[model samples]
Target: MRKILATHPLHPRATAMLAGAGRLAVASALDPKTLTTEARDADIVIVRAPLPPELFQGAANLRAAIRHGAGLDMIPVEAATAAGVLVANVPAVNARSVAEHVMFAALALLRRFRVMDRDLRAKGWLAGREHANSTSELAGKTIGIVGLGAVGQAVGHIAAHGFDLNVVATTRSLRPAPERVGFLSIDALVEQSDVIVLCCPLTAETRGLISRERIARMKPGALLINVSRGPVVDDEALIEALREGRIGGAALDVFSVQPLPPNHPYFGFDNVIVTPHMAGITEESMMRMGVGAAGEALLVLAGKLPVNLRNPEVIEHYRRRFPAGD
Candidate 1:
């Protein structure tokens, strides 16, 4: 039987499926060193945590690294490709979940949900009711989406149709804009949007895309919602902006650091909403991601290439490593 390793436990359905394909093991810890050691003998790895590039060196038996979700940031694809290990991901499976999260965060920030909830329990109903005067409505507001991917498109649909809000987007694609959605330059979007939602993937060009300069251009009291990877925004610059009350508020789901330290300054601000990188994790999405990852593992073990292969260049090398009908 082939050996399989998962960085984290999967849904019971997925776990059972993988178990039928190979001798599956879940990592006890997620640190690079621990993952590298545990994956040394793994024939396939279901990746949830970040895998170090060095892991491809020691894991000679590794046939593929399958991401549990759409993001490729956690898996070192270049190293895996160089080492003849296939890289695959379950793309856009959680787009609805993440898009819903963007809307949730926007509404929460606009309505001061966090502060109102806290004070209502502590003070009284009147205390919470008084904040309603400051709260804003979602309708008629312009939502600027960064990156017009599946998640971004979903957010735009909801913003335009569901909430009767105007939608604008910035994307690298040359395709025509969706009906009722206006495409704009990033600078124009920042200046014009009442709320800015980041759904872009982290890339060379996207790293630090939201800088202090761009934050400064935002209209006063503009809401920022980030469901993308953390490094896409300059953390210090955002903090500085938030400190000066330059922007209205922000809802951050991903941070540069995992398990943000207890005293992280983000926790100090009532205007800032911080989540533990769970914007894409709902019960339904988790099952879909888990099952998709398990299916990819099974495909590779059966001598078939994954449907969503991220590193297609590795196919020739991978085929040589595990010859057909071996």
Candidate 2:
């Protein structure tokens, strides 16, 4: 039987989908050391957790590494391609979940829900009601989105239709222009928008995309939300901005560092909302992603290419290793 290893367990429904293909193995935890050992003899790796690039060094039996989610930053594509292994990811499966998360953060910050609840518990009901006059509504605010892909599109739909908010978006694709959202350059969008949401992928050109200079361009008191990768925004610059009160407030779902150190400055800020990179997780999205990953794994094992293949150049060596009809 082929060795099928999962960095973490997939949904039972997805396991059933792959039951007929091969034997399944799982890591004890989602840590680096555990994943490296579990991935040792895997013919196929279902990546639910971030893995080390060194895992592919002597992986002669590895046929494919499939990401359970859209982001490939968690999986090192360069090392996999160099090892002649196929890399694939399931995209757009968690768009709705992340988009809803952005909306939740926006409203929570605008309405000062955390502060109000804290005062009511610590002091009295009157102290909480005293701050009710400061709350703002979502309607009529201009929302700027970075990267108008699946998640951005979903956010635009809700901002425009459900909340009656004005929507503006920046994208790499410009000719056709994404529908239902006005197109603008990043600088212009930041200047005009009341809120900015980042859903862009992290890349060489995009790392530290939001620097001090860019942060200075933002409309005063404009809220910022990031559901994208952490390195895209300069953490130090953002912290400085938040501390100086140059930027109004921020809701961060992803960070440059994981677990964000217990005494991190972000933890002390009332204007900032931090989450443990779970914006893309929901019951429905988990089901869709698990099912999608299983289907791609089965395809690769059957000597066929995955529909969401990230590295096509690996095919030349891959076919030579495991021919179509072996």
TM-scores, each model vs. reference: 0.98, 0.97
What is candidate 2's CA lDDT for residue 14?
Answer: 91
**lDDT for each residue of candidate 2 in 76-161, tens digit (9 for 90 to 100):** 99899888899999999999999999999999999988888889999999999977898899899999999988999999999999
Candidate 1 residue lDDT tens string, 1-326: 68889998999889888777879899989999999999999999999999999999999899999999999999988999999999999988899999899889989998999999989999999998888999999999999999999899989998998999999999999888987799999999999999999999999999999998999999889988999888999899899998999899999999899889999999999999999999999999999999999999999899899999998888899889889976
Among all candidates shown, the one with the greatest lDDT = 1
Model 2 TM-score, all chains together:
0.97
RMSD of 2: 1.3
Clashes per prediction?
Answer: 0, 0
Candidate 2: stretches off by over 4 Å: none
> Local error of candidate 1 at 8, Å?
0.8
Q: Could you tell me which 10 consecutive residues in candidate 2 have the lowest summed lDDT?
A: 172-181
